[model samples]
Target chain A: MTDQRDDKEFAAFLAGESELADRYQALGSEQPPVELDEHILAAARDAAKVHRLEFGPPGGWLKPVALAATVLLSFSLVMKIGVDSPVRYEQVVTVSKESDSTLEGQSEPVFYEQLARSLPQRTLEMKNMREEQQSEQVIEEVTVTGRSRSIELKDAPMAVSILGSAEQSIDQDAALLIVAEYVAMLKTKSDSGRFRLQEMERSNESTAKEPALTASSPVASKKDWESIDKLQTEDDSESMLREIVRLYTSGSNNEAGTRLDEFLAHYPDHPVSVKLRRRGY
Target chain B: MLPGMANRPDDKVLMVRYRDGEVQAFEVLYARHKGPLYRYFLRRGLGTEPAAELAQEVWMKIIRTKDRYEPSAKFTTYMYRLAHNCLIDLSRRSAYKITQQVIGDDIDVAGLPATATANPEAEAIYNESVEQFRSALANLPDEQREAFILKQESGLSLADIAHVTGVSTETAKSRLRYAFSKLRQQLIRNRDKA
Candidate 1:
């Protein structure tokens, strides 16, 4: 489908073999004017000058100085931030502490009110402990007295028939009953003597001789007995009723009955006495 | 290649050296291509003044965009592509003016730079043939004329002509073939009339 003439012409064009090429070369001998050449060369030189200024030589100091300044600025910024952070944190902590103190001050009255409310309960606990201690002391005194009487009786001649062996044994039992009654009376003052009982049980063997030595002296026993008598006189009816209950729990019905009678005699019109009477004490 | 062109550095190297702030490299490059580039614009249907101006503009543009020039293609291809684009831009800006100029006149050989000829009579005949060739080139269609001009002015490969004119190699070859066939016909017709 191709024309041979067109192919020849295309081939000649590729080979640059046409007469038109030589003529075209002659036609293209025209050069740009000298003034135009001067203008362009001057422009190129000026451009190269501008390029040199913009992209300085590789050996120039400006780049190194710029890099150093950048590094120094970065280091300074980091150091400043690092130095300031702890102070800022401390300021925050101080503010928090101040706020906490203000809250503590605001809550002080509530704390005192709670303390005031707890005082009576604490006082009741102390009173119970003291009463239990007193009861124990009374038992110790009674035991010492029984033993001293036995010793006295032994030291006396056999002709002293007024305090024989049988009489001595009966007196010991009666003394035991008296000590139990006294313990029942003091026990009324306590809501709970469980802690005191535990302490006594632990210390009983170790401290058995200590109280005997202290209470064996007549003067010491009298002083302790006077304190017990004063406590009994000042004992309130409510605590006396509690003693009756404690004696009942201890399987000492006679002692409980005696204490109940004494409590009724002291406070006949008392509400606790009325309750006790209803309970058939 | 021109006389002593082989002795000098490559065009791409000269451009690279110029890009690195060497004025002498750019001067050498300007000297090497200025005439051909001016004639390229002239053969593309531009008057001498306009051709000179466009050639200057192309060089200035090359100077402006020196940093962007990559050595990926032949320097001739790159330069001609820029020249082609400038020509297209000028045509778009004043299509009527360029059309009138293209149709108005043929090249005046007297006004052209003198060649170092050994014989004056042979030179005169060659000059007449050159004038006829210029007329025939101007009469050719714009694409064919540009294809022919790139071929003559830059001595670029057919592929390079295709690259500069943004055409396929086959299309560039076809344009060049048609240009040569028409120019030969015009020259023969003009000679026969004379």
Candidate 2:
């Protein structure tokens, strides 16, 4: 019952019809000192200045220029990389020819040796015949012979008998085995040939090739052979391997050391490995 | 400024003008509500310096954040909410000490001389009674004091009070009830003394 009375009194007091309400109203009427407005406006202006300074000039253009430069630089770098890469067209063709010759040579070593020996003579004869035929007629013919096989070559004519040896000579089951072995051998020969060709192409294309030969050339008068010799001796993979072994033994695995480890793992029997092992490894 | 013109612009129009760099629109808003915002801080027992500082900060905040302002509610509601936040922020920063005795003592009873209809002796008695009642109001909890002040000073409806206080209407009403009951008890004690 008392709680009910308290609740009623509280409700009536909240109505604000009492003396307390008037005093609150009077308290609300108190005025603050007048300088606050100036201080706050000054702060706001400073903030506005900061906003303008940070975001105003060139805000519109910076993004597009940055974006355009990024795109242009990326495109230029890609084009430069593409252009600077050594072309391997001749290398690829050499590898393909070596692989094909290896395949044909594998089936009959004696025949291939005989053929290889006879090629220079045959080429000379063909050259002479072509020289004679060129003056008289547009048509030309030539003959080629192997140990047990012969072929007649004519202009624009393809000989299919060279490819028919395995099919004709071997039993059907044995022929498949020969074909598989031939393919595996061809694949191995092609891979090694490709690597060798690529190395040759890179060496031919780079000025880094044949420093010793260039050093001896009379035309290369201005060349500093001593510095060249020093550089070559320093850059010799053997020296690099020795430096790597020294670092590893000293427990100083810097970038060169890391690169040496990678090099060793990648090409363990590389020519420098012998020197590397002799030095420390 | 024309009377009430500062208060009369549609909040949306004022906001749009303010966005377009019409500083006058913001000045008008400041003028329209400066008295109410000042009163809000003053009634909460904040000193004159802090109250004025908080009021100015509230306006500055409105100016700084004007670009983000949307008039989804009445401008007056938004203004009071900003003022409330500034006051709370000021209190937090200063950790201002608010005491019931200080609140009660700060009220100037001399300013409100008793009505002439009462005998001089009786007026004196009434004035003392009013002072005592003010003291009791100071003793009320901060939320109750704020709810009571918003109701009396702004004439805000319960919903408006709730919106300003960030409380439900029921909670606001409850606070008001507690504030009034405490004040009524003090006034009743004063009436007995008279």
Q: Candidate 1 residues A78-143, lDDT tens each?
A: 988765442210000012344446545222222222222232333343345444333332111112
C-alpha TM-scores of all predictions: 0.50, 0.42
Query: Native contact fraction of candidate 1?
Result: 0.75
Candidate 1, residue A21: Cα displacement in angstroms equals: 1.1
- Candidate 1's C-alpha lDDT? 0.60
After aligning candidate 2 to the native by TM-score, how far in Å is the CA of A216 from where it should be?
Answer: 77
How much is B76 displaced in model 2, in angstroms? 3.3
What's the i-RMS for candidate 2 in angstroms?
Answer: 5.4
Backbone clash numbers for all candidates listed: 1, 1
- TM-score of chain A for the candidates in order shown: 0.26, 0.25
- Candidate 1 has a DockQ of 0.39
lDDT (10s digit) by residue, model 2, range A56-120: 43345557878999999999999888755542211000123444455552333222233323334
- Cα displacement (Å) at residue A162, model 1: 74
Best by TM-score: 1
